[model samples]
Target: MDSALDYKMVFDALVVPAAVLTPDFVIVAVNEAFLAVMGRTRADVLGHLAFTAFPDNPHAPNDPAAHGMQVLRASLQRVVATGERNALPLQRYDVETPGRPGVFKERYWSAVDTPVLGPDGEVKLIIHTVEEVTDFLHQLRRYGEREVDDTRTALEAVTTNVYARAHELHDLNERLKRTAGQQRQTMAALKEAIERQRRFVFDASHDLRNPITGLLTELEVALSEPSTDTHEILSKLLRDAERLNEIVADLLELARMDTATPGDAAELIDLGRFVVEELERRPLTAAVHTRTDPQVMVRASRIRLARLLGNLVANAERHTTTTIEIIVTTDPPDAVLEVIDDGPGIALADREKIFERLRRLDDARRKDPGGSGLGLPIAREIARVYGGHLYAADHPTGARFVLRLPLAT
Candidate 1:
């Protein structure tokens, strides 16, 4: 099977706006619809980073988090990091005007980024697709405005006829009251949407602030010292950038988990096989061993389950240096998986606290400042979504993390 040919055929065939980007986010190919959306030719974007070609509105040049740039970057970075599809919220992304080279026009989009895994099972390309919702949103705004105008006109007519007839005026008053009630409901819904958007921005900004500030501080210090070591400065800059990337990826996953519902689609995943595959894909210093009942299976979202398992193993790797054990078994109606590490274990007091969002031990923070403090919380959320629970218990040698899920028929 020629993956390159298949990629080309699929890329050219899709009518929906789409582009193919390298793992580093360089645009290598785009379909006509995507080109139309950006108002640019292949020659202009083919070799450039996706963000470089269509930057966020210049009004926010200094504040990438204020615009949708961070959200979009986070979505693409997640696909690259975790090899999972990610959807961005409806964003007010602006694109270059057709004839105006540097000028941008306001647009709204519902965007998604999906990973294209290579034969080696690593993410090689990311397919970015977006649906332009600008016109639809404009239509909605117009409809709302028209309703307000009609309400005003009706109110004026009623006021003019207020002295004409008492019964008629009473009927008009009742109708107006009902209209007001409906408008209030609409306003409430709109307010809720605004609040959600505000919360999303606040969370993103809060998580992004630290790394960015650190990056700037490091650069400033480096610049102040004329004899500063360029190599050392670059090394610290790279680490800070990587830290920012990790935080963004975790936030994206956390957002996904927050919106995941019990009604989400499920698949029958073999516990033993899945555990082995996940372990094989990750790089760890600890020697890993597994014990499993090959027959055990669970009906759950494969991505979510993989995420849960991956987080447990990753947490173990961060804390332990010697050996890791992964065991899978079944107890009648439930399948159980446990990860045990041979390292300093968590205190009994902090076992449950570790699963809370952004909660990390002082020791763990000292060990790894780049940790987003979201992995355990996200893993537990995924477990609950699939009618399961994840917890850490005291181990004689080290920490023991366990995941339990309903067995598939």
Candidate 2:
């Protein structure tokens, strides 16, 4: 029941676009927003046919204006005749203001035309409403395009950093390869030095063995027939020469231990019986004693094990002020040998360093000037080869050296 003048007041207060048209489709009234969008005064749009607003005149500057208006008029005529609200989906390029430049966006209008009936039941006026939504459509497209560009830039930076790291890694690998080659060359030089040392010791000992035996044999014969004073001097010379031979023999044996692969082990040997038999050979002024748990056996290189026990026993005898104790015992998994002497003990500081080659704790108390410092070293190395160690143990009255060898079942 609203007249065009009453509808004008309601539409003016609305935030949306509204227009009233005559039955002939002439625009009779328009709100402030619709007039602003058309870019003309209310005088230009009011009393103007919807066709004139988007005119078909040949003089109109925009060429597509006539066709666009024709299509819109046909849609509007159907809505007015049927008294229905028709939603028109206009494409991006279809909806545009005539005579406007640089304009973008396709506007969509949810338009409705309601025909006011007259007393004679004939159409008197048509009402059309439009809502402008161009800004919303424009912002959506721009944000999506910007997002794609940002993603592409981020991916490019990651790829560039990865490529740079790969190049740096390749350079580092090349340096490591060069360093490895140099190390292998150094190792080869060390191997050659070891071979030369072994050959010299073996050759020198081999060459001296025959001459030494001959010298001692001839000296013994000469001493038996010589004058008294000269015999004493010759006897002393023979004794000194024998000591030198012993040193050379010990050194030569140790040098061979380096190149010597352990010989296959023989049947288990009774360590106690072996020590007892070895004792009969040594002429000790003090009583030498041997004690062990019954059935005590060691699986070791026979020659090396014999030499290891010999060095310990002789060391104890050389230094003992009184009785020397050689105790062989077993504790479940390892067999231990303790050689005790009552002589002056080595200083606490020198205990560890005294085992090195040529190290002597007390040069003044040396009973044997010809004693080569290889005995303990040789024993330790032999123990290591058999998977064990030699350590100086606590002795309340004197020096105690303990040899621990792994017992094999």
Q: Return the TM-score for each candidate structure.
A: 0.48, 0.49
TM-score top scorer:
2
* Cα deviation of 361, candidate 1, in Å: 1.4
Cα error, residue 268 of model 2, in Å, equals 1.9
lDDT of each: 0.80, 0.66
Candidate 1 TM-score, true structure as reference: 0.48
* Candidate 1 segments exceeding 4 Å error: 1-207, 221-232, 262-265
* lDDT tens digits, residue span 1-409, model 2: 5454665567777766778888788898888877665456788788888877755433332523223355457657755675544443321123345667545324433344566767976667777766555565445556555777665555545444443453455346546655876898899999988786665556446445544765676677666967556766576667667766776776766666677755646457676676777778767766677787666777777778778878877777777788788888887688887888887766678777656644555631368545666688788878888877897877887688888877767
Model 2: residues with Cα > 4 Å off, grouped in runs: 1-230, 262-267, 363-365
Tell me the deviation in Å of residue 378 in model 1: 0.5
Model 1 Cα lDDT, one tens digit per residue, 257-366 = 67757455799899999999888888877789999998899989887788788889888888886889999999878899999998899898999989867778997898
lDDT for residue 281 in candidate 1, whole number 0-100: 88
Candidate 1, run of 10 with poorest lDDT: 159-168
Candidate 1: residue 247 lDDT (0-100): 82
* Alpha-carbon deviation at 193 in model 2, angstroms: 10
Candidate 1 lDDT at 120 equals: 86
lDDT of predicted model 2: 0.66
